[model samples]
Structures are given as C-alpha cells and as structure tokens.
Target: MKQSVTVEAGGARMPETTTPHHFVAGIGAGPANLSLAALAGRHLPERVVLFDRQSGPSWHSGMLGADARLQNSWIKDLVSLVDPCNRLSFLNYLVTTGRIFAFLNAQFTAVPRVEYARYLAWAAGELGTVHYGVDVVEVDFTDRFVVRGRNGAVATADHLVLGLGTRPRVPECFRSGTGLIEGAVLAEHLDAHLNRSEAPPAGQVIVVGGGQTGAEAVQCLIRRGYRDIRWLGRRHWFAPLDDSPPANDFYRPTYQKFFYQLPDEVRRSYLAEQAYTSDGISLDTLQEIYRANYEAFLRDGRAPVMLLPGRDVVRAGSTGGGLGLWCERGSGGRERHTAGLVVIATGREPAPMPLSAALHELVETDNAGEPLIEQDYSVRWKHSTAHKLFLQNRGRFTHGLADPNLSLLSVRSAMIVNSLADREAYTIRDEQVYTMWA
Candidate 1:
C-alpha cells in the first residue's frame, strides 16, 4: 500500500504525479552522490535517486583545460576503489568505449581531466536515476523528508544525502564598490573570454593565487600568446604537492578511522599542519610553466611569465583601461601592479547547504554552525535514527583531508550506504599500513 500526500505546486496545493517516494534522495549529482548511486544500484536498485540543478552531466566544465590532468590517479574512480568489477568502473568505460588500447599506449602519468569528465557522464547515463534540470531549493521534513524545487514538491524520501559541493570564493578585495570588476574575471570563466572574436590585447595580465588553478590560468595565458603576464602567490615560493608514501597514508580508511577518534582540537591542528598534502600544485604543472617560459624566452628574448611570490593583493580597483592592484610584500613593503586583465584563482569554499530553517533547527550543530557529522558521515539530528541526513565533501573537519579529496570518494559512499542499510553493504579493507599515528 502507498500513502498519498498533498504539497504546494505551481502556487497551488496539488498532488505529486510524476516523482514517487524514494528510499534516499541525494542532492547535487556530483561525483560524491554519483558514486553513491552507482553502489546503491547494486544493492538498492530503483530505491535511490539524485537531483541536480544542471541540465546535464558535467564536472567543472568551465575549468576543463585542454591539457589539464587530474590531480589524483585514474584508479581512484567512482567504483574501482571499492568494487573493481563494477560495470561502472573507469576501466570498464575505457574498454567499452574502445579506448583502452589508446589510453594504455598514451602512457599518461595522470589521466586528462576531460576524459574523467566524460567517464562520469557515461556512468551517470548507465545509472538512469539522476533527475536533471531540477533545482532543489528547500528540503523540509514532515512524516518524511520533502524535497521542493521552484515548482514545489519534487520528491519525498526516507533519507537525504547532500553532496552539495563547493563554489568559488571571491575575496573581499573583488567585492567592494561594484558587483564585479570590468576587466577582471574568475579563472573558470577565462576560456569564454579567450574565445571571443576580438582577442585581448597582448598586455600585462595578472593571475592571483598560488594553487593549481592559478598555475593553469598562467599557462593558459602563455599559450594564448599573452607575453607580459604576472603570476602572484602569497606563499614564499610555489610548492608542489606532497604525494609521497607517508603523505598518501593520510588518505586511507585506516587513517580516517584513527582521525575520527581524536579530539576536535587535535583534528583541527592536524589539518592545519598538513594542509599542503592536498592543496599544493602538481610538480608536473610547475615544470610545464617553467618550460613554456624558457622556450618562449629563447624564441623572443624575453620570458612570458613573471613569478611574484610572497605578495598578497590587498586591494583592487579599476585604472580606466586597466586594473590596479595593491599587494603586500613579504619584506614589509607595499607594491602596486597594473594589468590589462586580472584572473582570480583564490580557491573555493563549501557551498551553503539548502536545508530549510525549520528543519535546520532539528539538526545538531557545532559552535561554528556546521552539522555534527558522525564517523559514518550521518549528521546528528532529532530524526536521525529514522530519517538520516548524510553529508559528503562537507566533512573535512570531522573526517580528515581525505573527506574532500577524490582519493576516498568510493570509501565514503560505501560507508554512507552501509549506515543507511544498517548492515555492511560493502566490505572495506585497509591492510598492512606502515604509519601509526595516535
């Protein structure tokens, strides 16, 4: 027997005719929830569904550079880490699409970002459970959780999973008098700007930030024949990612379990101390930038990029036809630089959760107003024992650096599915780890 309920729809109270009640409704069909949907299909077929605002499958499409490679290995795909034999594995995609031999012969140290994006789209197509073009605005709870979009009740579910993901964090300097600067843009939007019929003048261009995105933006400008480009970083010197053996240990399930048992203060301190393990730029990317600059200098008798580290842009303003930047140097001196265009790659912060106010009050929160997630990735709430609110990518402080990184996406999804089923859905095994941190 099925229970019917009325909900607000199109400014009028009506009944939901299209979407049926689901066992679990995942918000944001990004890699996190896509991974969950893949695993859940094996055990809870036709029971789970995901809603995404985008019209179709895409992962960081705006920033997908032509030569950009994934920071993590290809093996750390949606299902391979947990169930290698799963039909949705990256290897399966390669073999099924007839690119396995070409991919193997290419001898890529790291797979291209575009290929991974396509692989995700392929997996999403096979699952057939994701609802596109549905923007979930408010998630509230009644007898069961109601997921509402602009039109009204989209679906109801016994449990909810938030893989909301992150958004670009624009700094205060870029937000003052006007909404957005005229000649400045985010790194993600650089491609569109570069593609315009009227190419930007070969003048001074500034890239602000020290991470991978910033390096990519600088490289993009150089490739586009922007000769006089300035790359600024707050760090003393640009650093490469620490993908060493011991650092890799921090991403394993064994380390995540140990990290969860520690006190809150200890976890915060550890994250701060080891931030570089995941945040640093790739060594290969840095080398590419250097090589490009060297080759350009040999041909033109002048370098394309000017690396300026230990300089933080404190304020920005327009200088009529150009942009003015005031930077604080490491030597306690202030410097000013002018550029025809500025690209901001400052980084990203967590996207704001879309829980309704009434429902948010029922969920327990930390002093910082973040949901108190347990070791199993379920948020502690009044109705948690019955209706769970599972979070992914938003558990960095609770779970370790691996929470946000791609290294542990499958493991995290498996933990959530097991918790939802109240049984071990997938057996997680981490054996012979050498590092012991207590």
Candidate 2:
C-alpha cells in the first residue's frame, strides 16, 4: 500500500486527496470526542466535526438499568476538569432542564446511569459539531486524512481522533452456526429482551459474570420476581470497588502524567494492581443487592439471588425446557445447572480502529499489534507532525487506567487540543499533589 494512491470513494476510484478540509475528524461521538469538541469549539482555527454511526447520541443505553448508578462521581463529566465553564457541563444540563433542585434534594450517593445517559444526549444536542448517522467504515490517508463512511469520503482532516468506545464481549458458547444460541442474551440487550417477553420466564435464570453488569442482571431478575436465580462470577467473591481517597489518586491528572512517564513493565504491574479501583462493583450497589436478597428471604422462605461466585461456565447447550450449563467451580470439580434464560454479563474490550490498509501500514504499532500511542494520545505515524492521529479512551495501555476512564476526560481533551493548537488552549491545573509516584 503506497502513500500516494487512488483512494476508494464508496466503490468508485477517487483521486488522491491533497489539501485538508477539516482541522480534526473525530471518529466517534461518545464522551471522549464530545469533550474534545467542547474544548476545541474556540481553540482550533479550522473546522472540527465528529461523525457517529448512531442516529443520535446515546451513552450505554442498553446497560442503563432502572437502578443502575455510575461508579464515578458526577463531576467526571465531559468538560468539567478543564473547562467547568463549558456549556456542556453536567451541572449546566441539570440546571437548564430545571432538575438541579430535584437532583440535589434526592441526594443520590451516585447519579443514576440513566440520568448520565440523558445528560450525554443533552450535551450532544448543545454541541453542534456532531454529525450522526454516518457510519465511518474506514479511514484512508494520502497527503491529508480521509475519513470515509459507508457511502464515500465524508470528511478530510489534517488530524484524526479515534474515540470509538468498546464493544460487548459475547462468549463463544452464546454463538452458533446460524447465530446466537437460543435463550441466550447479552447484558446490554437484557432490558429490551425482557420488555418484549410475552410472560415471565419459568425455571431458573442464570447470569454469568461477576462485575457490575452481572450484579445488575441479577438485580433485574430479582426485581422481575424471578425466585430461582443463579449468579456466577470468575472471582471467588464479588469484589467491591476501592473508592477511597488513596485509590482515587490514580485517577488524578497529576497521577496520569506520572504514570505515563513510567516504563512498560512498571506500568503493566501498576495497572494490574489497581484494576479493582476502576473495574469492581460499587459497594453501595452490592449493599442494595444484598438488601434486596434480605427482603426476599424475609418475604419468602428462599432468596431469589443465589451467588455462585467461583463458578465459570465452561459449556452451555439448549435443553428441552431451557438451557443446561456446566460450571467449573473454584473449590473443585464441575457442576451442572439448567436455566430458562441466560444473561452474559461479561466485560468489554476496546473497539477496533477502522484505519485503511494504507493508513495502517504507515502507523507504528507495538508487539501486540496495537498502534504505538504517545503520552498525548497521538499515534506515531509515518507522516508529518503537522498532520497527526489522536486516540481517545483507547490509550489505557499507554496512558494508564485514567486513559479509558471518565475521571480525566476533560484534561485529556485539553492536552489534545493544546497539542493540536500549538498553544495552551486550556490550563490543566491539578495543584494538590499529596502522593508522589515519582
């Protein structure tokens, strides 16, 4: 794949592109790109637009359970850390929509996930840079970045920012020759599946995965009055998040900077050690589930949720009445359980970068075949510094845990903006430094 070659426009051969049309072509309209757009509104000289595949903006709608609450604080919104005065701030959304007082009165320990989704939609509406319904299939580059959608070259940019969020991890057992196994559903689609159900399912309901999503699936089942429910997790027990002050230090901008400077071996170890801080279920959520179980126990002789934490579902098959699953227990041996329906609450991985073959050949990658991203989230490509490619929420390996997290969203955006603008567009100030990683 040569740098100077005919690029495909839809199916037709288009001439090679030379001049840049947009300053930055952001590939996803999620929170990360939204943060960049919010801060770059006045910073960049050229036009900056984000193209999303969705008909409109939505954040984790499938997993927005009725009782689901965010593990992180509300202040971790799109533009607060760097630009609190930005119109897209979560506080502004609450106040503008006349829910500020009500929100304050409710005194939620953590804001509801549904509310956060709504806030994202609101922010998307306010930010005029997003162009929805454009499914960017591939991105090609010649002299300038060419972002192509399902149709043709939708936009060209001097720089590219890829922020396509993660996708749900569907296990092999759930898939079949034709399609997904019968009566098997991913956690993201559980709500819609339940809604469309003609009646309450008979027999036991099994939810696999011990993370927050898994717990939520169990809670949803309990709320739906599923008396016999089996909750399985890989861990020995459901782990609660370490949200203490010391744990939170890892999420700070100062800490992010420190973590970026460390060697790969040290960084990998630190990431493994601090996984629970970002990955574990919230303590409050666990308490809620336990309380619900307590209530069910008091109301009936048996509880609805039977937590089998150490069991790993090894095999699954469609049975006469339901589905039969074999679990490998942590203690020892294997056991079989049947379920009317199965909800896979397994985790997610970073989405694939849709770079064209020519573009991919130019970008440097690590031994794992991942693009070698710098501290500022810029991809080390075989191109001029004036033209660059940036990554958002796709730099956890390079930028520490905070890279994929919402804690330093605005700060990250600010760094990207400053880098592109070649000036300090936003002052990223985190003066208080109690613990030093260096």
Candidate 3:
C-alpha cells in the first residue's frame, strides 16, 4: 500500500517521504576514526557508518615512502594501546599476513610506514561496514547528529566522531605561491624529487624545520642524488644518540598522573618544552643520516648534507631568479640562503568541521573561539540536546598534547566508545567546558 505523502501538515511542509537509515556515523576515516570503527566492528552489534573523504583506506599515502619508518614503536600502533587483545593490532596484522617471522627477522623496533598503512587497510577491509569516498560535509545535533555527506544523503547517529585530520600548515610567506617554494609533509616525495633531479645551479635545497619531517626530508634527499641540502632549524640539531632521553619517563603512567594534575597553562608549557624531544627525528634515523653523510665525507667528495644549526627561518621570498630564505642564527647573526627549492617540512593543524545550520544555535565556543569539547571529546550543547556529537581528532588544546599525536589515540577511542556506551552517566573531565547559567 503506497500512500501519497506530499502535503502541508501543521507548520511543516512534507514534500516526499524518505527512507530511514539508522547509524552511529563517524566522520573521517583516518587512523583515529578508523580505530573507532574497528572497535565498533568488534563490539557494536548496532549499525555504524564510517565516512572518509578519500576513496579508501590510506594513512598519509601522499608521503608513504617505501623507506620511511614509524617514529613510535610497533606496540604503539592504532589499536594495541586501547585493545591489546584486539585482533586488529599491528602484531595481529603481521601474524595474519604471515610476516611475523619476517618482521621479527628484520629486527626493527618500529614497523615501516607502508607496512602500517597496509595493516590499516586490511583492518578496514575486514571491518566490512565502512563507507568510502563519502565526505561528511555537515553535522547537526538534535537528538543525534544528522550527518550529511557531499551528496544529499544523510545518516543519523547517536554519536558523531570527527576524525577529520589535520591540514598542512602553509606559512604567510608562501601566500604568494606554493610553486615559489616547495612545502611537503610525509617526507618521501622530496626523496623522489631528489632522486630524479640533478642538483640545481643553486646547489642547496633548504629544509626549514628541525622536527622529524624536516630531518627526514634532509636525510632522504641527501641519501638520494641531491648534492647540497641545508637543514635549517630554530635549535641546533643535537646528536640524538648523545641525548637519548628515556621515552618511558615522559609517557609513563606516573608522569601522566602528574601531567593531568598540573594546571592547563603548565601543561601547555610542558608540552612546548618537550616538543623537540617528542616529535624530533629518532636517534636512529638521525644517526643513519649522519653516518651516511660522514661516510660520503670520508670518501672525499659527496657529503652534501649541511646542517644550518641553531637558526630560525625568519622570512622567505623569491630572489632574482631562485628563492631567497633569510634566517636568524641562534649565535646572534642573520644569514640568507639561495636555494633551488625550499621545502617547508612543518607539520599540520586540525581543520574545522562544517556544522549543520539547524544546530548552530546549540554550539558553545571556547574563549579562543574554538569549539568546546568534552574530555571524552564531544562538543558541548547549550539547550535541546538531541544526540551526542563526538569529535575524534579535533580537540588538541582542549584534550591536551595527546589529541593529535598517536600517543593515546587508541585509548582515546576506547574511552570514547565507553562514554558512548554509557552516555547517560558520562562526565566530561576537561576544564574547557562550562555550565550555562540562564
């Protein structure tokens, strides 16, 4: 029996009847969102929808260098921290692929980035309920979040997980044009560029940052055919081996207790101070590059890796023909370098979500005009809450330094799930949220 439904009833105008779809929808299929989906696949009997802008599973595919390795240990993969017993752990992936023996044979502490991505893809495939090529455009929170993708199709979820990843940070100097200077994340493309191209007449390629990306880019390019690559950094690139800080001490359970207890300002300060230690190139990677360059030097001709230590890139612009990068030296001097290509290996920042027009009134912003996220990483509502809106990768300042870093991603997922499971009783622990006193 088909009933015609097009009519104006009450104050609502009904055009046509639409089929109902039930789902707890997730936005973004990056590692963080995928981690949540994987857990849901294992635990949730109810329908769950996962959405990604990309066509399918890819973790930093743009920079998935064949030779690039992970900074964190294999145990620190997507799922192990939260659900070590989960079958989707990287160890499990290796075992399932029958590469456990081979991987162990390689005697590597951290798995290669490509291998990890493959593991993620395998997990995504088996998850079986993921939606590919669907970019969730808007989310409106009523009772649940009504998530709309690029198409007019909408999915309603009791909870929404926003794992929309970071955007590459392009500085103001590069506003003129990206072609003027090359800025790349995920180090491998630069490697390929250096591999295929000969050193320009300018001789040097300036890599601007001392972090992992910067160091890895310089190292990879120098390893390839590039003759001269200048690694510029605000701080001196120390021999990581000589300063091998214990990782456990920083991320230890005891430290986390103290860390969480500290005031937010102190926590921010602490994170700022440890940025180099946490995100810098590992001692091993740095040492390998240093050794390779040293060997090249010993061979008497091909040491092309030059470290512009203790300097910050102040300004960069096009020179007469090439590119001019001006820097401030830590030793109280300013210097400029002319390079054929200047690669900014700086990292990324979280991008904004397009909230639905219906729910704009409910959103509460922080003092800094950022969305107020709960400790469990849900956006707070002012009135008439319909559904839960969870943000996965979006809360950095609110959730502490662990938000974007892969440090506690899995545990965060688990906590999010637990919070969703017991939504009625959940309490947000973060200080960013406040009660609206009407």
Candidate 4:
C-alpha cells in the first residue's frame, strides 16, 4: 500500500490524504536525532520518523580536510554510551562493514572526521527511518504535532524532536549588499575554493577568528603553498586545547547533572572559564602548524604563517584592488592589513527553531529568546505534557558545556528516550566519580 501525506495550508487543506500519526516525528536527521532513532529500537514501525533537508547523509563535508580528525573518541558514537549492544554502534559499523581489523591496526588517537561521517551515514542507512530531501519549515500542534515541510508534505506526531545542528556565524563586517563581501569566504567553503584553484595571489591571505576553524584555515592555506598568511585572533595567543583529566571530568554524566542544578549566573561564569575544553585548537594542529612553518622557513627566507593575536577585526573595505581590514589592538593600539582573500572561521551557533508563530508563543524562553530545555531535553510549552517538543544542541546555557559537545550524544539521547517511553529505557551509569567538583 502506498502511503500519502496531506498538505495543510492557511485556513484550508489541499485534499483528503491519509497520513500516519507517528509516536515521534524528528526535525533533523543529524547525529543527535540519529542517536535517538538507534535507541528507540526497530520493533515498532511508526515509533520514530525523521526528516532532513539533505538528499543524503552528509555531515560537515565541506570542512573534511585531508588531515582533519574528530575531537572526541569513537566510543561516544550513536548508541555506545548507553547501549553498546544496539544495532547501530560504531563498533558494529566497523565489524559489519568488514574493516574491524584494519581499523584496529591503524590505532588512531581519534578517528578521522571522514570516517566518523561515514559511520553516521552507515547508522542512518541501517536505521532506515530518515526522510531525506525534506526541509521541515514549520511545526505547530493541535490534537497532535503538525510538521509542514518546504515541499508541502505534512506529518503528524504525538511528540516532536528537534536536532537541528549549528550554522556558521558570519561576522558583522561581512554583511554587504547581498549580505556577503567579495573575496571573503567562510572556513567551511575555503576547502572547496582551494580545490578549484590552488594558487595564491601576491597579497597576503588573512584568516579571521582564533578557534579550531581559524587554525585549520591557516593550516590549509599553508599546505596549498600560500606563503604570506596572517592569522588574527581576539585572544592573547593561540591557546591549545586543555584535554587534561581534570578538565575532562566536566564531561561526565554526574557532572552534567551537577552543572544543570547551578544558578544561571554561575553557569555563565563557568562556561566562560571552561570554554577552551570544547573550543580550543588541538595540540596536534598547533605542532603541525609550527613544524610546517619551521620547514618552510628553512627552505624559503620568510615564514609561511604569521600568528597575530589580541587583535579584533573592526572594519573591512576595498583597498589597492584587495580587501583591507582595520583592527583594534587589545593592548591599546590599532593595526591594518590588506589581503587578496579573507577566511572567516569565527564559530557556530545553533540553527533557529522552525516552530510556527502559534507554536512559538506557547514555548517559554530565556532572555536570549532560546527555548528553555528541561533536564529530559523537553521544551517547556503551554500545551499538555502528553505532547512534548525536545531540543538538542541548544541548551548550552542550561545544561553543561557537554550540551553542544559530541561526547555525550548517546547519554543525552537516552535521557530523551526515557522521557518519551515514560520509563527508564536506558540506564546511564557514571559510577567512577573520583573527582569531586566543588
């Protein structure tokens, strides 16, 4: 039997088409939602349904550089943290794909990003619950949740899950006529641009933003034979990531619970203090950049990359047929530079919720207008508790820093699954608590 989805418009409906009401309808088929689908099980057909705008399973494909790797371990995959025996474990993916021994022999400290992306795709394919090429535009509720996509097909569900990941943050200075400045591209697109043309001009290439993306951009430029590269950052210096044991204690489930119970003001302070754990550039990347610069300096007279920190990009304009950037120095001074091309690697923020106007009014929000997510990952709304809306990758303020990190995907999904099933579907055990966070 062919299934049909009714299209709903303003005031009137398209036609009479039968649509199956799902127990849970998910809005993005990324890792977060994929984790939930993996643990939700395969016994029930209509238990979960996911929609994504992508035509296929793809994750950060633009930024998958040759040497790029994952920050977190492979053990924190879709289902491992909670249910390793689940059909969609990363280990299972390797074994089923007949590469377990080869992968073990490689013995990577952290797996490659490309491999992780393939693992995610394998999990998505194995689950077979994702509806690709469907962009969910609006979501509201009446008797049940109504999800309307850009293609006009609609779905209904008793509960909803939103796993819309983050989008790159465009700097304020780059908002020109078309909201984009020529010769300025995001770090994500730089690789594609380099692939098309691997040559550099006479003018220097400037990379803005000081985090991992910025570092990666500098490294990419260096590898492509761009000799004159300048890196600018707001921080005092290019700091390496603090992957120490004490810093990692904050990522445990017990610590996550503790951080959630803290006051909002304290949470903000802690996030500021502990931002580097999740945001800083890896030591391996730093060493590579330094080593590459050394090798280049040994061969050529001039170094490849110039590290300039404590400078904030204040303005940008055209000068000498190239882009010129003005910056305010942190130590009470100013500087300017001209570049043939500029790469913006600032950071990423969560994608906006696609809730309809009616649905938006029912949900409670913090001062920043972000939806307030509960401990179980459910949003606080005016509707009955029976119909819930859960949000992922948008609760960094309420939850700990682990909210946005991929280290706790399965644990967070387990929390949501337990709420939906109205039972303890997965047990989250963090018994090895040696560090007492005061």
Candidate 5:
C-alpha cells in the first residue's frame, strides 16, 4: 500500500495517512489531461496527478500509419497556445532533442502523427505525474473525491478532471463478427493484424469509412500490395477536409465564445451541418491516394482501389471463407462485396464516465444521459460550487468543434486551471477577429 505525508493546516498538524491527496486528480493521461498536468505542474508541482490504464505513453499507437500525418498545425501543441514560455512546449522538445534544424529543413506541411505521439511522451516524461498501468475503476465523492483503482484507493482530490478521451466505435454489423471472422479488424488494430496475417498481397480487401482514418487504411492496403481493394463511404464523394482560413475560424477561441452564446438547438444544428470541418479526409492524403492509384494504373493497366462512395455498410457476415459486407447505396440500391480482410474505420465515441453510482447520482445529466458541461467544461453537479468535476473532449455539443480538435488544447487547459484555482493562472486572450460571429 502507498503511504501519505502530513502537513500543517490551520495551526494544527493533520495526520495524512496512506492515500495521496491533491488539488486535482485527472483520469486518463491523454493529451487533454497531459496538457493540464504540464501546466499545473509548473505552478503546483506534485499537487496534480493523472492516472491512465495504458502501461506507457502512447497516442493511438496502432493507428500510427507509416504516412499518417497530423491534421492540425504543429503550433497547436499542448502548451504553446496558452503558455508558449512553458518548459514543455513542442518547440522546446525539438530544441532539447536536437532535431530543430532537421525538422525545419524538412518543411513538413503537417508533422507526422508518430512524431506528435513522441512529443507527448517527452512531455509526459518531463512532468512525471502520470501513473501508468493503474486502471482507475471508480470515483466517489465525500469530503473530497476518492479515486479508486484496481488495487484500492489511489488518491483523493478536491477536484476531478475526466479526460477519458475516446474509444473506437464499432458498427453494429461488425460487432458480433469481430472475433469469429479471421480477418476482421478495427482501424486502430490494423497494424497488429497486418503483422501477423499470412494472407496474400493479392487478396481482396474492403476499407470502410470516409474520414481520414478510412483514407489511411486504403493507403496502407495499397502499400502492402493488396491488388483488389474496395473503399466504401456514406458520403457522395470522398470529401477533403475544409482547412481554409474561414473554416479554421470555427476552431478559434473567439468563434467558440460566440458559439457558446447561441441557443442549444442552434448550436447542435450547426455542428451537424459543419461536420466536415473537423471530420473529413485531409486534402494531402486524398491527393496522395489519387496519385498512387493513377501511377499504379499506368504501370499495371488496372487500378488497385475501387472508390465506392455513397454506400453505408449495413450488414456483415461470413461468406465463403471471407467476410461479406452489405452496403446501402445513396442512390437507393443494395450492394454486396466479399473480401478476405475488412478494416472498419468508422469513427470514435467518448469513453464511458468512471463515476461510482453515488457520485453519478449527484451529477446532473442531459436527456442523452451525458453530463451537463458548462462553458468552462465543468460539470453542473450538486457540489460544483464547492468541488468541480471538469470534462475534456466531452463538450462538442457545448464548446463547438474546437472541443475535440487539438487547436485549443492549451486554451482549454488554462481555462480548467483557472477554474480550479479560482484565479487566472494563464492569461487567455483572443483579439482582432476579422469576422463578426455575433
């Protein structure tokens, strides 16, 4: 069992026993909490800790394709947006690792996803507040919040921040057939599946989903020399991400503030209408796929990939020693395809909240049973005035498109830190907007 230290409070020595105490205890050491830990550690070193179930620092390690690149700019790192002077900035990482010159020489429009993952690991190592391999099971509130892991009570905190990121969303058609089918795999697990499979390079493969992940999966299959590949998507065309300046305005703090002031219905409707701003395939990646297809066609006189857009995979099953997929076409017809391997890259949903029954009862929820997140990302619960329970990446409905994107990571962290300390720890300034969102 872990032990605790005592300190003098109110002119008396308190007997602090085995469990550690902190001002804030965050669950999950993803970028969201890692950013918070980095900022909090500077001001309140050893006063904030993050618990993660993973054994080590990794961000979507399985999906780190050979050519996968970050959709956002490198400057939108963990600390630079709010506190560029902080020691854990991405620029500092490059300088410390002696890769600044080489990185600049490369002139990458978007840095590789693997490089960003390494930057996060480097920051996590510097902070040294993440407790890995500790699966925080339940969180209950009494005098303060008690965070219980598999071993027992890991720590207690005056406030809690849930950054339990997201999990890969499996379609209902593929859910039951996952283990029974030999070659079925989720996008996140494709790397592992490819490593161990004995399938031939000429095998037929199906890549489902229209977003970035789906495009990446198709590229991976083509690189692996898969001759017959079918790419299916629900959209009429494989739409490229709207990364123009005006589209990017939606990710700024000014637009976020304007969005938060709108009626709930309007905000929700806008999000539905503008999903492509954040969820579409990168233009570069789409171009690469097209160029690759054209080059291969010129050499072999046949294209390897068949782009089957406007089709939604509705049913899946096993057929003739392979996986069979049934898709509902946008033009009102049903189509079927059989492939030796099927990769599902649909999307992701927020991970389940790790609140105990009692604590969950105290927190107010919306009609969908999600916690009512406020403008500052704090949950509107019974004890919110006294003790806060903040959420990260769980406010797309409340905070707009910027909530899940990496563009405003530091800004969000600064907001949470200010809320926790009841004072401004980092100044958040957004000025001189060209567009009037009001």
Candidate 6:
C-alpha cells in the first residue's frame, strides 16, 4: 500500500488528499539528486519526495577511497556552489566538525574523497526530504506518474526526477568470465580488497585508463609498496587539466549560455570529446604520482609507474595461474602483459533501470532512445500533458554538459528549482484541480 502524507510548503500545510494532485519525485539519492533536494528545500513546496535505492545517502560508494583526494576544488562541494553562506555548505560542515582552521592551514588544494562523502551524508541528514532504500522501480505517466518501489510502495507524482547515475562502462573484452581480463570497479570495498591482497611477484600491476580514479588506483597500489606497474591508456599519456582558478569558468552558470545554444548532436559529441579532460585527474594528482614513481626510480632502477601510450586492450584469456593480456600498440606491435590481475579503470556510463514495460512505452524519445525532454527537464509525451517530470541526472545530452557532474551541481539545482517554481506557478494560475474530474 502507498503511504499517504502531506508536507508544509511556504506558510501553508498541505493535507494528505487522495485526489490526483501535482507531485515531484526524485528517483536516486546521489550527489545530483541531493543537490536537487537542497535546491527544493529552499524553493520547492513541501509535496515533493526524493527516492534513493541505497540505505542512506552515498554519492559514489564504489569510488570512495580513504587515501583518495578529490580531483576538483573544495568550492565545488554540494552547497557551496549554490549558496556559500548556506549552513549546509562544506565550509559549514568543516566548521561544525572543527576542521576549518586546520584545513585552511594545511595548504592543500583539495580535500579527501572520504571526507567529501561524509559531507554528502551530512547534507542529506539535514535535508530530511529524501526516502532512502526505497528504490524507484517503475515510473509511468498518465495524468500523473505512479512510481512503484521495491516493497510495493506506489507514489503518484505529477513529475518524476531520475538521478540514475552512471553505470560503470566495463569494456566488451573484459565482460566474459571466460576471458583472462577481469573488470573490477575499484570503489569502496573493492579498493580495500585490492590493498589487503599480498603484493604480486615484482609488485607489478597493470592499470588501464587515465581518469582520476585510475590515477588514484595507481597511487594506492604504489603507496602500498608496489614497484613495477604499467599505466596503459588510450591517450598518449596523462595530460594536465587546465584547472587554473579562472579556467573554472567552463563550469560556472554563465558557461551554460554557450552550451545551450549548441545543437543536441553537437552537445552529445562535445561531451564525448571532452570527457577525458572534464572527468580526468587534476594536474596536481598527476604530479604526485610522477614524483612518487620518480623517487622510487632514483632509489633503485625500480620504477613504480610505466607509461604504455597508444596501446589498447585487444583480447584477454588466461595463460595459466595469472592472466595474459594482449594489447595493440600505436606502433606496429602487439604487446602482451602477464600480471597477477588486470584492472580496468575504464570509467562509467549512465545506465537507467528499465521501468515497467508499459511505463517505458509511455515515454517518448528523440532520434536516439534518450527521453525527449522540455526545457524544464520534463519528458514530452503525447499521453501526459498535465504531469511534469524533472529528470535529475539523466539529461546530460539534453540539458547540456552541466547535468551529470558535480561541476555545476549548485547552479544546476537552482536552475531546476526555478523550473519547478515556474511549473508550480502555472499549476496555481490554472487552479490545478485537486480532485477527480467528470
């Protein structure tokens, strides 16, 4: 049975009415979803509800590593981008935990990823509008959407926000269990597992991909006293990110002006082209890894980092106890590496859970299968005109580059709230009927 309830909006208290009324529902509780909640808390009427599949607020549980440091500036945290003065800002979080002065004195450019995770959890705790562990199973649009959850919880919302974050994009070669290549998403527990394992012979590890996670994984294995490691990436080598304070202009609200004007096809192509830089590790991390490896090399001929540029994993099969990896190099050679284990730091792509077969049929799409959304991030379908669905994180292609990452989360939240406010105003102007019509 669906739990019926109402919440306070502005100075008015809404009652638990059974009639089809306007509703806002968020499907996932990641940073993107929580950012939406923070925005809504300040602006959304009390009727909105946020849904998360996890037991609590966890942005990226798989990638959360203790030794891992954020690749972005500290100001890019949840609340700070939107309202630096807000009590929920990271500065406030630090002050609450008595780390403000200490952090300031450290002279570090970024905070630890674990600490940032804690900040997300703290922010969620204060928001209080989110429903954790209540995984949204299906979203359908009639006059309103009947959102079904895992334990038979059905919620009717006029709008549904899908923050279904990226699914790890494991390459085709590593997927088959029969292959020697193992696709391991080195996040949370998996990181600990890799750390605890006895160092392989010669302490050699093969890491593919050059993103922030890949760099961190390399750092972790090296710090754990591993010496021989090869970082085989698609690019020439890890390139530095132009993260100068002014370069942040690429991620600011003003940047959206240029992003929005681009055609959808251009937007899609741009995201694919720039994924490496926008999501790649900062220059600082690159330097740290290089210095550590250089120190190891100077101490002995043993270098912790090896660069295999233009080499891509081609095929994988077990040679024996360990694993044999075959790769095609930029030159005319097929390089083979045998390691204790092969780790694919290959990043993630957005994967949306299938809604009910019927529900899926109700939503319309463009030339691609992506949802055709209005400017407010509402899915445009012939069947549901009254219902407004705010797609949280799934609109990267439609909403431009700012939709997916935490880069524009604060301003993105504000934008979404403005859209929701406009939606509410329209409903109010029409005197949106709260009861069934004849």
**Candidate lDDT values, in order:** 0.88, 0.84, 0.66, 0.85, 0.86, 0.67
Clashing pairs in 3: 142-386, 143-386, 143-387, 144-387
> Per-residue CA lDDT of candidate 3, range 117-192, in tens?
8988998887766667656677765455666554544455556667888876656765555543443323435656
Pairs with backbone N, CA or C atoms under 3 Å apart (clashes), candidate 5: none
lDDT of 2 by residue, 1-438 (tens): 111212232355343354226778899998889888888887888546888888787888888877899888899898887788888899999999999999999999899999998888888778766777778899998778888765467678888999999988877877788567888988888889989998765578999999989888888887777888889898999999889999999988888888888899998999999989988998988898889889888988677788898998889998787888888999999999888899999898899889999889998999999999887789998994879899888788778888888888889999999999989888888897889675
The local lDDT score (0 to 100) that residue 114 gets in candidate 6 is 80
Mind giving the per-residue lDDT tens digits that candidate 6 earns over 60-82? 66666555777667787766665
For model 4, what is the C-alpha lDDT against the true structure?
0.85
lDDT of 3: 0.66
Give the TM-score of each candidate: 0.95, 0.94, 0.83, 0.95, 0.95, 0.84
Per-residue lDDT for 110 in model 3?
Answer: 64
Per-residue alpha-carbon lDDT of model 1 for 1-438, expressed as tens digits?
A: 122322322354335555468888899988999999988865763456888888889899978887688989998999888899899999999999999999999999999999999999999898877778877899999888889888788788889999999988888988756556777888988988888728555778999999999998987887787899999999988889999988898899999999999999999999987888999999999999999989988999998899999999999988865999999999899999998889999999999998999999999999999999999999999999899999899889989999989999999999988988888989999999888797
Report clashes for each candidate as comma-separated counts: 0, 0, 4, 0, 0, 2
Q: Model 5 — which ten-residue stretch has the worst lDDT?
A: 1-10
Clashing pairs in 2: none
Question: Model 4, range 361-432, lDDT digits (tens) per residue?
Answer: 999988988888899999999874888899998889888889889989999999988888788878899998
TM-score quality measure for candidate 1 = 0.95
Q: Model 4: runs farther than 4 Å from truth?
A: 1-17, 42-45, 198-202
Instruction: Rank by lDDT, highest first.
Output: 1, 5, 4, 2, 6, 3
TM-score of 6: 0.84
- Candidate 2 structure, TM-score to reference: 0.94
